[model samples]
Target: MSARARERPGQHDVAHPAWTLVMSVAASSLSFIDGSILNVALPAIRADTGAGAAEVQWVVNAYTLPLAALILLGGALGDHQGRRRWLVIGTVLFGIASLVCALAGSLQTLLAGRALQGVGAALLLPNSLALLNGAYSGEARGQAVGTWAAAGAISAAIAPLAGGWLVQQFGWPSIFYVNIPFVGVAIVIALTRVEEVSDPGSARLDLGGAALATLGLGAATYGLTLWSQTFALSTLAGGAIAAGLALLVAFGLYERRLGDKAMVPLSLFGNRCFTSLNLMTFLLYGAFGGAMLLIPFTLIEAGGYSPVEAGLALLPLSILIGGASRMMGKLAEKIGPRWPLTIGPIIVGIGLALASRLAESQSYWTHAFPAILVMSTGMALAVAPLTSTVLASVSRHQTGMASGLNSALSRLGGLIIVALLGAVLVAQGDALLRPFAMALRMMGVVAALGGVAAFFGLSGNWRHADSGTETV
Candidate 1:
């Protein structure tokens, strides 16, 4: 790509920046909200469906697994086909899946619905991001991404509270039902407002690679989920893990053969900055996921708080992330991303350590708020810069794939950590509080390691990425 093209490619084509931002951000928010909305509702769902600990974890994992698995294909498809078309199809599919979830009669049925919801999310998220990347350029692009991240964080933050209120006023199913109208609005706006964007020069669809990825991730996640039930190494889980690993290995080798035609270009991983950023993403997001999974359970089951109270406890986290994201994005631009990325996760680790104190006391002010605030602050400092770095690391054509891969790794981290924690939760039983504290401490350690990785991995001059070229 030409230097001018690399720097200012998006500036020339964008027709409706404001509307594009609104629709893309809204569409993406549905996926974000869906990701976390079930956290507060998990207890209620368990009560309603007689789901055990393992099943409850499946309720979360069912959504995350496919999302992590197929997201690359989703991005590739959007780039090969059309972003707006896939966005609309994904929105519609998500709405339909939400309805199925709302009407599910059993835990099995709900898990099925959640899995389908994840498929829609895989289709939605990467394309929405690609649309955003296509709509703006340079500093405006950074600001747009910051705004998008803030909106997503706020939506994620509101999910638990909104879900709690819905469960209290109506029922647990109401959370799923409520998504219909919002999905409708998002679809209408997406069709009418967002411009069509796709790469005419993109490679053909990589169906074989997509299938391999799906099978590999599904098998691995299933193995982890089943392993969580026994804590001990079971033969079935062992086989599944081995099979999953083999399949992933096969997929990697196959992609290497395909070269640039691959769904995820192998060349992108050659960038040291890209690889490091994604590594940081995995560790930090995994810690965040494990901590989030525990919070509602700790509050409602052990701390004796109602669902509403549990949901409300996180409201300040939303506000802090939303308020601080743009400023931090600007800060990252001014001073570069290394220090903020390195320091931010360390602060988050401190926050998780503070949150571990919650196991001893249910005092919202003394125990919950401070820890949540600190974590939120750290996230605010990191998220936008993280996104900016990922996008900048690749060429314009690779935006969708880069975003999808980063998102997948991040979700995969969460998926693994949450499943592992679920096993611990089941083993602890009545002693939920102690295990919860221990899990927080473990998450803190993981997050601190992410900070350490960022410190060593990222460069002071990372803002200006290398020109997109085949490098090894």
Candidate 2:
């Protein structure tokens, strides 16, 4: 008859006596593949659109922006509605978007479709983790998450190679078209293996908070992109930068008035370990995201390699990143997550900084491979621990939201880094490229900035993340 007793029954119902680890991992992998696949298609996309650099940049930015800004909201939405229903809906929408992208006749249409796909991705990512949390408990939860992370790690490794081949053999459309078969398989598996669950009570959507957050993030990302045009502030760029900062501040005040979607649970910020861990995720992922953006082009523009060749150059690192993620997950449980997370990015950043110093006259093995290899080593070492640390920091109830936010922040880091770094390279290339030295130098600076954040921000005991907090 008591209020606390009534709440306990509903919360208890969310727990799982039977968990489906394979289903969770498979669902998570599909989400990861969707993200990594498009990157290899960017060059082919440039040729097909007849759009210049700035316009072509939108193809990547369009998907990344909505995906980043809305991921937390997506997680919260799932908690309010039915996570399974949302997951199925998300998968279907992604398929529709992928089809639209495949058939798009104009650049605008393709970008719109990519945005839809991003929305679907954001929807699916967090709910999948939330479902996983509901199914498993304690150490079983760790193993299930490890499986999910590993599956995603594998997909990230393979997407580049697969996407490159698809682009070369069939053309760019094949990249989008490939997603259709995946959608069917995922839907069938999810329907059969996953149980449906939703909150019986309703929660407010917080439209005002959502709008400010979206506009703020969008403006900030856009302004930084303008800066990439010429690190110096032109009249237009300066104006945009001012506008973005103003909007971002407005977003913060708005969120304070309302609340984060069920996913972020703003109170998590009160946990220093949680906040710091997220930053570490952002920094490491930014480096990872920026590398994905630049490395493909390096092989294509500088090395005379096809898209497939670029993917091939990345295989070593991709494989390593996955392996390292698995290793870090286990290690985090042992030595603690902070050490690896800190050390990994520093190593990767050093490699990137070294890469910035590379000579055009040098070959991949001599000039490029060293930095690439070192960066991969650092990345491989860091991902699992950083991810594990975040998951460990949060309450069981919000695991899905936490997972989604982790993924989103990583993508946001990439989305912004690529926008800025790519812009810088393009704007400066003409002026600096007669020598090729300056381009490399710029990359090193970018890499060093990422490393510095990882080192300073990753100072905490992720192992003892106060797991006693009650799940809301």
| Number of backbone collisions per candidate | 0, 2
Q: Considering every candidate listed, which one attains the maximal lDDT? A: 1
Candidates in order have lDDT scores of: 0.80, 0.67
Candidate 2 local lDDT, 1-472, one digit each (tens):
2211112233344434243455555556666776677767776787677765556556778888888887777766776666777778887888899999999999999988988988888778777777777777898876776677667777788888898899899998888877777677767766665666665342335556556656777777677777675577777767776777788677666666556443245766776666766776676677667666765655565546688877776777767776666665567567765567667777776777666654345577876778778887787777656655666677665554566667777887778766675443453223333223444445445544544555545564433344553211
Q: What lDDT tens digits, residue by residue, belong to model 1 across residues 1-472?
A: 3211112234334447777788777788878787667788877887888887778888888888888878878876777678777888888888888999999988888999999899898888877877887889987986797678778888888888888888888889888986787687778767666677776466347888888988987788778777876677799888988898899998999899999888777887887778888889999999998888888777777777667878898778777887887788789888778888888998999999998887544578988998999999898888858876776766665665676788889998998887777655564335777778888998998998888888877765443344342221
TM-score of each: 0.90, 0.84
Go through the candidates in order and give the C-alpha RMSD of each one to the true structure.
Answer: 4.5, 4.8
* Candidate 1 C-alpha error for residue 387, in Å: 1.7
So what's the TM-score on candidate 1? Answer: 0.90
Whole-structure CA lDDT of model 2: 0.67
